[model samples]
Target: MNKIETVKIPRHVAIIMDGNGRWAQSRGLPRAMGHRKGVEAVREAVRVAGDTGVGFLTLFAFSSENWTRPETEVNDLMGLLKAFIRRDLAELHGENVRIRIIGARDNLRGDILPLLIEAEETTKANTGLTLVIAFNYGARDEIARAARKLAEQVAAGVLRPDQIDAVALDAQLDTQGIPDPDLVIRTSGEERLSNFLLWQAAYAELLFVPEYWPDFTRDVFYRALAVYAGRERRYGGIAAAAVTG
Candidate 1:
């Protein structure tokens, strides 16, 4: 049995699912196959997070930079995303999970936008684990969009410049009501954020594992949770003794 039950489980966990192409290349298979396998890992992660009492799980599914990839691969990914939603939506709803998406939708294709809306509408009131899918999401873009919104308000005299602070900006962000991530995990030995959740992860504990995302298993997730549970998060202020000195 896993020892994670003995430690504190994170209320929110975000993941950068990296290395699908590499995993496929290493196995002499097509990259698409790797992505398909990665979908399985996504299912497992959701199950584990739900079972372990995690309230929120945010996944970096796709990024704005991904548009520069090959067109065929992009289409394949979009197809996979649609399939995942259509196939898994019912099961997720049955499990009392709420689906939420973060990212820009203004320019999304007509077909894609509805699917995303359907997922949210279908699970709006589940009152269970909330799955946040960051599709076409970039941290910088999210921040910039928020800034633009605030700038417009300031320009229109609806708000003063001085009133625009972290709190005001956060309300404009895609993750306004969601709590910040307690832990951010990156697979495939990557130590960088890759623009996953920059502002929200300001004080998050990071864990980088060597396993490719497609190979990410329940064990790996439990181990990462264990590591997070062992850490001392001071959030800037030190102990009372250290502060006095």
Candidate 2:
């Protein structure tokens, strides 16, 4: 398919990379192997998003809840993350892909902290596709953090409770300046949000595909965009042409 010519791609796309363990189990392999394979899919995803003219691609790399998994698996995931950054950082920077990481970083382990920082600092000046890696993130945690900031402002007597509107709260969010995702996708046929982008996805379209995360190919990304192109986003209003004409 001529994706750029035929599909109306969304400006920001977020993906929940699910089914790694399941995919490995299905293939009679260790879960760590599945996570390794998922990394390859991530590379293809970034490439596809850039080629398709997507301005922002936010990947749900590791959620806050992911910390509850087995220690070995969690360590494996972290290792993979570090490996990906070490291996792909220079290339991504050279290609002008800026990296933005959103999550609570105060609790990050000593060794992992520097790597994440390096990725962000190295690509902060690049102006191409903004690759947002949502590591150790949860929508509830993000919202709670935003709420705390607003509460602090009110307690300082600089802001009134009544003045705290959606815009005020949005400014305190981890995604303060980032555009809300236009499309959210979950592979492995999952139909739930799984605690991802609960606030930012207020009006985003969701597309669930049956393929596992490891099998999510560039073709699948194009297919998702094609699906999004056919949607009629009323955004709680009547047809624009009818109202304006």
Candidate 3:
């Protein structure tokens, strides 16, 4: 395998931590057990990213469509999220990791909203890698929400319809200030984005690994970064090497 180029590290990396339930079911264990184990993977990913010099790491923790799952399972997932924040917040702050949540919070449950707010507020001053948790996030929903905000601005005569270009709309996104992901990875061999970071991943290098989220390790993360380093990001233009060749 090729070595990871330290200088080529992505500024932001986003991951769709998939196949937690499947990982448990395949082992004849409860799906909740898989999610619990996946939490450990999340911890390792953060540490690895920080150590690898990744400035930002976005995790697709939960999607808006997740609400369609079984109520008991949903509740269990929520409990795990609460537990993770309560258990890891102080440690992350001490490590200089900034916590950022990018998702619609308009109607989040009372219990969940406060915890999310607390996590972000507690780590807002950190200077290290920013850990972005996309809880209840769906890229399409996020785009629509941003569009609605633009519409409202137009209605109030604060902006004109002709001025609602990509930049204008981008400013209204939940990830407004954050840079777009440089690489997007999905575990469990999932090749599709599944409504994760559609807008922000327009130019990201996408990688799909067969391991489930629970099986993700620092080694696997490092391997993915190596793959990313080898790719030539053309961004719709010919690579400089190609042009020179």
Candidate 4:
């Protein structure tokens, strides 16, 4: 079946796109090929989400620890990202997708930062979907940054000590305007968060698919949605209606 079969879409879905290097290695490629193919998967996934009317889609593009990789690979990845934004920005705007990059902007490569800003500005008013790309982003670091900013405000007497609470912290997060994900899918059979969306994913349904990111096409996305349909999300409490369907 095609990607459109994935009905009952979640409001927000986060994906941990893993296994690019491993997939490439098995094919005797230099890993860059895998990354390139994974880019195709991103497009397909976007189409499927758009078709299914998913409000928000966040892809774990690059993590804070990804900086530890060799310079060659990092450069290659950055180039691919730049190329993607340049080539896909217009198409994304045409499709009514608001392109947003959420991460430590200061840590990003200079060339990419400007392109990201332009893309965000170019698509800010789109209403179809919100695609959040996490580059140089870490949940721990985000929390720390929020805390640091709040502390500074308190020290300056601009904020009261008793006013700092979960609500206040939530509003300070990078994903302040975004809703918590209803489901999080990790490809390549990895189920762990790897420091993704710590505070936001407290009640998200986790699904680990054995397929690699490149292989995670429209069909797999539909299957995940079907699986999610069978679940009864409790969100830290019991269902009120005896939830037996």
Q: What's the TM-score of each model vs. the native?
A: 0.96, 0.96, 0.97, 0.96
Report the Cα lDDT for candidate 4.
0.91
When summed lDDT is taken over every stretch of 10 residues in candidate 3, the lowest stretch is 1-10
RMSD of each: 1.5, 1.6, 1.5, 1.7
Off by over 4 Å in 1: 239-245
Clashes per candidate, residues 3 or more apart or on different chains: 0, 0, 0, 0
For candidate 3, give the lDDT of residue 115. 98
lDDT of 1 by residue, 1-245 (tens): 55466448999999999999999999999999999999999999999999899999999999989989999999999999999999999999999999999999998874888999999999999999999999999999999999999999999999999999999999999998999999999999989999888999999999999999999999998888888988878888796668779
Stretches of candidate 3 above 4 Å error?
1-5
Q: Give residue 121's lDDT in candidate 1 (0 to 100).
A: 99
Q: Residues 1-245, candidate 3: write the lDDT tens digits.
A: 23345679999999999999999999999999999999999999999998889999999999999999999999999999999999999999999999999998987985999999999999999999999999999999999999999999999999999998999989999998999999999999989999999998999999999999999998899989989988999889999988899
Model 4 ranges off by over 4 Å: 3-7, 240-245
lDDT of 2 by residue, 44-135 (tens): 99999999999999999999999999999999999999999999999999999999999888899857889999999999999999999999
Stronger candidate by lDDT (2 vs 4): 2
**lDDT ranking from best to worst?**
3, 1, 2, 4
Clashing pairs in 2: none
